[model samples]
Target: MRTDVLHAMRLARIDLTLVGRNTTVLFNVLLLPLLMAWVYTEAVGAEKIDGVAGRVFVLAGLPGLLLVFAVFINLVNSFTARREELVLKRLRAGQPSGPAILGGAALGALVLYLAQVALLAVWMRRSEGVTVANVPMLVTVAVLGVALFCLLAAAFSGLTPNAELAQVTVLPVLLVVLVGAPIAFPAGTLPGPLGDVAALLPATPVVEIARTAFLGGDHLSGGGAALSTGGQWMAALPSFAILLGWLVVAGLLARWLFRWEPRHG
Candidate 1:
């Protein structure tokens, strides 16, 4: 209803304001990835990659991991903190419906995600001289990835016992995305079944989706093309299904496990 939309919008503004004021949240949401990108680029300049187009693959995959960090790690902490402080409890008794409250809480991260996407666009256009060929695919997949991770993040929030433990609780997920996925090293270059194994991780398809969008574009000349950033529409079906499958599974788990009230107190 119109009333729910209005309430959600208002909640989004309030959450955005709070996020803006939190320096730690702001840095992780905005600067950490920027720092990583800079370091990756600098390492590339030092011939650390040992492969041509390494920087390109790095750029393409960084956004997905960044999104995972922001939503899975940072936003989970935010929600957990609010719940522990009884904010969620108060909100539960509030006038806003459940959907509005959840939507609004997520809207801040959604904004940050969009901003990060724009930043990635600028970086690609200016530094790599590359642009996304399938703009719609880029946008759709990015949003879909965020939604999946955000839902999972919320589900995991209940597992975090306290605000301080959020970092520890999210470590497994961070490690999975960091070590499991082919972000720093190209998927194609991975030895043996490593790349194939990575495809099983959630972040893999998200990164592949974005990488395909850029490489599939006409701007960049190919150099170290090992794995196909498959351009054919049909080639993407498996990745899309995998991500959607994870999202559905996570949603089911969230419905069963997510807590609206504080767990400890």
Candidate 2:
């Protein structure tokens, strides 16, 4: 068991090194979202959504964007590139257990996600005076968000024919997670059945969970109420369950469909 953990750690270190050296990966992982946040804030300057500052609203939704663009899309491309290069094939034949192999491959993205959140938290705290209402709840949900998106990336990687095709393959999921969720749209603003359907989308609950931590309300109700930390966590339970459900589905698909070698070769 210790050997397997060591193998994963070594693999993760290599992946992180590679990611660091790639300028394109760094741009998407670090700069793209930063640009988006700046644009959103400028476009909606001083406007309030659900009684929260527009910048705060944008900050709360930033994780959802990161999940789609930074983690999910980038991981899909990375997995497909590795598979086409026969990297995964070699790894599967090596000492690492299956879960350890995948976990290690994904660790770079998880680390980046955490770094992005921490940096953004500092920026928001300085610029917007945003304070976290429930730090533990935020951390817990953010980790879950990363886990869910990583699983989704793994599952989608199986369907992507090559690194180039990842751009096309990830579009549907991007639409679902980014457009259908509260990131692009206002929370609890979707009307009628659209709202119900949006609630079930994987990213919906995550956005809600972030709101609960940062702004003190669930997705269905916009921020601006005082809830105890426990109450805030309680409000996010259903959203948490929704995200967990999607995580299970993604995990099953990844287990069933992931390919170690290139499809054509």
Candidate with the greatest TM-score versus the true structure: 2
| Segments of candidate 2 deviating more than 4 angstroms | 218-220
User: Model 1 — TM-score against the truth?
Assistant: 0.87
Candidate 1 C-alpha lDDT tens digits along 83-163: 889888898788888777777766767778878878888888898797766677777777888888878888899788889
- In model 1, the worst 10-residue window by lDDT is 217-226
What residue pairs are clashing in model 1? none
lDDT of 2: 0.80
The digit string of per-residue lDDT tens for model 2 on 48-127 reads: 77777777887876777777776898889989999999988898898888888888866767788878878888888899
Candidate 1 ranges beyond 4 A from true positions: 44-52, 191-193, 217-232
